[model samples]
Target: MPSVDEIRGRIEAALPGARVTVEDLTGGGDHFRCEIVSDRFRGLSRVERHKLVYAIFGDEIGGPIHALSLKTLAPEEAK
Candidate 1:
């Protein structure tokens, strides 16, 4: 079970300059919802963008982290 800051840190570290917001939905650290904005997501499909973020977690997605809901966006798509 990862902390909110830990999840945010991992995403930020993986996508330098990205704006990441992670919330622990269950309060147990296993379910989370994250929104990430980054230039790296530009030109990528929605699935591709999600895959990029998901890759950062690897096996942790189904292990300690039970569910991770993501909202990935390119800089231009962010508001």
Candidate 2:
């Protein structure tokens, strides 16, 4: 079970301009929802947007973090 701070660190490290808000949706550490905003997401498709985030987790997507309901936005969309 990864802490929110650890998840935040990984996302921020992988995507320098990212702003992330993560919540444990099921009272457990596995199920989560995240709102992510990044300049790196600009012009990307919805699948691509999620893929960027998934790439960061690598094996953790199904190992530690079971589900991540995500809302990914470009920086301009965030504002």
lDDT of 1 by residue, 1-79 (tens): 7999999999999999999999999899999999999999999999999899889999998999999999999988888
lDDT of 2 by residue, 1-79 (tens): 9888888888889989689998888877898888999988999998999998999999999888999899999988986
lDDT (C-alpha, whole model) for all candidates: 0.93, 0.89
TM-score of 2: 0.91
TM-score of each: 0.97, 0.91
**The 10-residue segment with the lowest total lDDT in model 2:** 2-11
Indicate which candidate wins on TM-score: 1
